[model samples]
Target: MTEFTEPEAKLEALLGIINSSARQAIAEYKKTGHGVPSADATTFHPLDLATDTLALKKATRLLEGAYHQLSAILAPPQHTVMNFVFNYNWACTNVALRAHIADVLEQHPEGLSVDRIADAVGLDESKTARILRALSLMGCFKEVKRDVFANTRLSLILKSANNTGCYAHYHSRDVSKYAGVLYETMIDEEFSRSHEVDKAPRVFACRKEGMEESFWEMMKNDDERRDIFHRGLIGHSEMMGTSSVLHQYNWGDVSSVVDVGSGIGAFSMPLAKMFPHLRITNHDLPEVMVQARNAWEENVPEALLDGRVEFVPINFFEDIPVAGKDVYYLRHIIHNWPDAEATTILHNIRKAMGPNSVVLIPSSSTHSKNLAVAPEPMLPNFGAGSHRVYQIDLTMWFLLNSKERTLDEFKTIAAAAGLALTQVYDLVETMVIEFRIAQN
Candidate 1:
C-alpha cells in the first residue's frame, strides 16, 4: 500500500469535494426543468428568478471551497498571494455603475461600438473600453466583436433600474470608503473598541470629510440616496433569498404579524402577496413610514385595499410596538446595533408580545460555536465559500459597529431581553429563528 503525503491527502480531499459539489449543482439546474446553463450562454437560467435556492447555495458553497483550496495549493505562493493585491474588479464595477455604462448599452441590444459608447457616456473611449473589458472577463459584459460591446445577462444588473445595481453602487462606493478606513478605526482613540453606531468606520470616514451623521440620519436627509438605500433593502432580500422564510416556516398558522423596522416591506410585502389572509403592521420611524406606505401602495396595492396592512410609526427604543400580534418579525434589524441597543430593541418587542406571540429574526448563519459545523475536509469557516457572510460581518462592523452573532451570542442577547429561543429554521442564505417568552 502506498502512503499519501499531507499535501496529497489535501489535494485528493478537495478533488472529491469539487466533483460532488459540481454534480449537485448540475442536478439543481436540471430540477428547474431547464437544462444546465452554459458558460457561453447570454441569458439567465430560470433558477436565477427563483426564491428558494437552498440546494444550489449548498452545492456552490462546496464547489467554491474546493476550487479555491485546489488553486491555492496548486499555484505558486507568490502568485496566489499577489492575486489579492492586483484584483480591482470592484473598482471596475463601480466605474461601470457610476458611468451608467450598462444603462447606455441597454439601448443597443446587438452591440455598440466602443467609440459610440464612450462618446455617449462622455468618457475617453480608450479608458472606457479598458474598464468594460475587465468586467467582460468576469461575464458581466461581452465583446461581441473587436471594439463592439454588448450586455450579457450579468450586465443587466448594472442598469440603474435594477435594485441590486443600487445596492452594488452603495457597497462598491460608499462601503469601500468606510472599509478603506478600517485600519484607522482599529487604532483611533475615539473609535477603537467602541460598539456605538456613531463610532463606526462610516462615521469615522464622514468625520474626516467634515460631515457626521448616523446611518439613519444620513438616509433621512438625502432623498435620492435614501431611495437607493430602501430599494437596495428589497434587493438585499432577493439576493439573500430571505423571502424563502415564508415557504420554510409555518406562516399559515400565524394570523397577525408586525413588521418591525420594515423598510419598504421587503419581507412583509412578500408575505402578504403569498398569503393574502395574514394581517401585517409596518413599523418604522415617521419618515420611513411615509416611504413604506408609498412602497406598499406601489408594489402590493391589494394588501392596502384589503385592509390587511397598516403602517405604524415607531421609535422602537422608546415605544412598544402595536401589541398582541401573533408574530413580531425583525429582518436585518438586530444586526444593526450593539449588544446594549439590540437587547433594548428586543426588550421593547418583548413588552408588546402576548402569551403566544413570537419574535422572528431573520439572520445569516449563527456563529454559535456549538451549532452547525462545516463538513469534514472543508475549512471550519468554509474558506472561499463563506466569502459573502464574513464580508457582510465586516460590513456590519464598518457601517454600524455591529457584528453577526454566533448562536451563543444570540442566546445571551435573547436572555438579556427576557426571551428564549424556541426554534431555528435554516434557509439558504438567511436563518429565521423564532423566540417566545421564557417560562422561568
Candidate 2:
C-alpha cells in the first residue's frame, strides 16, 4: 500500500473535520436557529470578536485547518487542475446551467420530466437530462423521483415572466457582444489590440455605420430581439436612475436639459418625468433619436410629454444643438472614448452652454490598487474610492479603450474643454461632477 504524504493525510483529516463540523453547524442552526461559535470566540484572541462566542469553535478550526491543508495541496502542479475545474464549474453551474434549469422548472410548475423540458425548449432530450442532472447537483433543482425534476425556490424565481425571467435577455446576444470580445481578448493576447479601432475593424461597426441599420441587422427584424436589448438598457437605467447622485440634482432649478447620447431616452425621459417643469431634449444620432422618440411615446408618462420632452437629432461630437438651457446632462457618454475625443465632446457642450449653465457629467471613478501599475492620480486626492469601480475600469479596458477616471482625470479633460469642475457628489457608485464654463 502506498503511504499518504503529510499534506494528503492532513487534507483527508481536515475534510473529515470540516464535514463533521458542517453537519453540527447545520444541525445546530436547524434546531436553535443560531450557528455554532468559534473556539476563539470566547478566548482573548484579537480575531475572536469576529466570531460568535456561544458555541464550540469546531467550525472555525475546521475551516482554518482545511485552508492550511489545501494551501499545501494547491501548490504548483496540483493548482492548475483545481483552477481549471473551479473556473469551468463556476461558468457552467453558476452562470449558464443554473439559469437554464431554473427557467425550465419555472415554466413547468407542475414539475417536468427531462423529456418534457427538452420538448418545450426544443432541445435534445439526452442533453436536457444531462443539464438537469448537473443543475440538481448544484441545488438549483430537485430530482423529485426517477428522472423527474421539480422547482426549488431558486428555479421557481427563474421562471417568472418579469425581471426574474429577464436574465435570459440580459445575457442574450446584445450584451453578450461585450462578453465575447472580452473572452476572445483574454484567450488570444493578440486579439487585445483588435479592440482598438486603428488596429482592427470597428467592433461596433453595426452601430458606427448607422444605429438604425445596425439595429435591423443585429436584431434581424425580430421584435423579441429588439425588446430584449431595450429591456437590458431599461434595467441598467433603472438602477442608475435610482442612485442618490441623480436624485440629489436640483432639477427644479433647471428649465431645459439636454441628454447627450441619450439612448432610447433612459436618462432623459426619467429626468423629464421627475421634474415636470424641466423640459428635456433627448439628443443622439438621427437613428437613435427615432428609437428614443418611440421609447418615449411608449413608456414616458403622458403628463411629462405635454411639451415637456423633445427628441432632437444631433451628433454630439460634431455640434450640439444651440439650446439655451440651465443644465446640460451627459451620462455614461464621456467614458466611451479616449481623452482627446472625450474632451472634444465636452468642448461642444461648453460652446453650447449659456452663462451660469451647469453641465452635469454623471460619471464613474476608479482606484489605484487594481491597475497593473498604480496610475498617478490625475488630480491630487481624487482617486479615493472602492475597488468595484476599479473592476469596472478593467472591464472597460477590454470592451473599449475607455476607462472610469478619477476626479482629477475628469477635471483635466474638462479643463481642455474650457470647463471647470465645480463640485462632485458621490452617489451609490456614480459621481455627478458639476462643471461650468471657465471664466476668462
lDDT of each: 0.87, 0.58
Candidate 1 regions with alpha-carbon error over 4 angstroms = 1-5, 369-372
Question: TM-score for model 1?
Answer: 0.96
Poorest 10 consecutive residues by lDDT, candidate 1 = 366-375
Candidate 1 residue-wise lDDT, 157-178, digit = tens: 8888887888888899899999
- lDDT by residue for model 2 over 180-239, one digit each (tens)? 455544455554554443222224423344543332244446656555545545454433
Cα error of candidate 1 at position 388, Å: 0.7
Best by TM-score: 1
Weakest ten-residue segment in model 2 by summed lDDT: 372-381
Clashes of 2: 3
